[model samples]
Target: MSVRPVVRQLFRIEQLVDMLLALTGKEISRLQQILRSGTVVYHYYRYWWEGFEAVTEDLQVLLAKFPDADPSQAFRAEQCTAAAIEQAETQAPAKKMEVEIPREAASRKRLLRARSLWECLMQLAHENIPAYKTYSYGRHADIYVWEILPDVRGRLEKAVERFAPRELRAPLRRILQSSGALRLRFFVPR
Candidate 1:
C-alpha cells in the first residue's frame, strides 16, 4: 500500500532526527572515521558519507528552533521502549511474532554508552527503521530530503497553493532563468 503524503513527510523528519541522534553517540570519533571511509562498496556512494554529515549540520540548524535538553537520550529511550514492547509480544507463542523472536535479543542488549554510531544506525536499518534513504534527483545526480522537521510539507503546500496560480508566469520565469532555482519550484509529494 502507498503511504499518505503527510505520513511520508512526517516520517522523513523523524528519520533525519533519528540519524542525527545516532551521530551523537559517545564513540562518535570512531564512527566518523568509519563513515568517512566509505561504508558502501562503490566509490560514488562515498558521497553519502559527506552528504550525511552535511545534512546533519543542516538538520541541527532546523532543530535549534525546537530546543530539547537531550534529544539523543530521548531517541535511545524510545528505541529501547519499542524494542521492549516487541520482545514482550514475542513471548506469546500463539502470536504471529513468534516467527521473529530470535532477533529480538536486542531488547536485552542495553549499553551504558554507544560504542559506535555506525553500528547503531545499521541496527536501526536492519529493524526497518528509516535511518536514511536516497534517490536519484534525475535532473541533477541526487537530492536529499533530510527531514526538514515541523510542518514544512504542509507549510510549503499552502505556500504553493496560495502563490502558484495568482502569481505571474513572467517573474517566475525570469527568476528561474537568471537565479537558477534561487526560489525552489513548488514541491508536491505524490
Candidate 2:
C-alpha cells in the first residue's frame, strides 16, 4: 500500500501490457496477411474463417476488457485502411487487367511484388499501425514473412543495380505504395 509498492506494481503492469500488445499486434497481422491474400475462403476456408472470426472478435473483446482504454480512434483508422484497399482494387479498370508477359518475366515481377509487399507491410507496422495505440511495439516484423526483411531489402537493392535493362528493372523499383496490393496486372502465361 506504500508509494514504492504502488509504483512497482504499475511498472510491472505496463510491461505485461506491452507484451500483450505485441502478441495481439502479431496475431492481427497474421490475419491481415491471410485476408489480403484472398485465401481465407479458399480450400481451407472453414478453418481460416473460424480463426479470422475469432481474431476479429478478440479485437472487440479487447476494447471491452480495457475499461480505461478508448480505442475508437484506432478502430476508425483500421476501417479507413480497409476501405483504402477496397477502393484501390475496385477502382482499377477491367481493361487494364489484360497484359502479356513471359514466365521468366512473371517470376521477376513476383519477386518485385514480394519485396514491395514486404516494404509496405513494414511501413504500415511502423507508421500506420491499425491496432490500439501504445501497442505499436513492432514485435511482429519478422513473424511470418517467408523471407526475412533484410534479405528481401538487400535483394531489392541489388535488383536495382544489377539489371542492365531499364525496361526490366524500372517497373519493379517504381514501387506503387499500397496497403498489401501487388499490382501485377496482365501477366500472360507463356
After superposition on all C-alphas, the RMSD of every candidate to the true structure, in Å, is 24.5, 18.6
lDDT of 1 by residue, 1-190 (tens): 7552422122354443334343443234443454455343222222233323434455446545432333122122232211101111233447412111112232223345332222332343344332212212221111111222234334433332333222222332232233111211111111
TM-score of 2: 0.20
In the predicted model 2, the residue pairs found to clash are: 99-186
State the lDDT of candidate 2 residue by residue for 87-130, as single tens digits: 12435456222222232332333433444332333343344334
The numbered model that scores best in TM-score is 2
Reference-based lDDT, residue 139, model 1: 18
Off by over 4 Å in 1: 1-20, 40-47, 50-84, 88-190
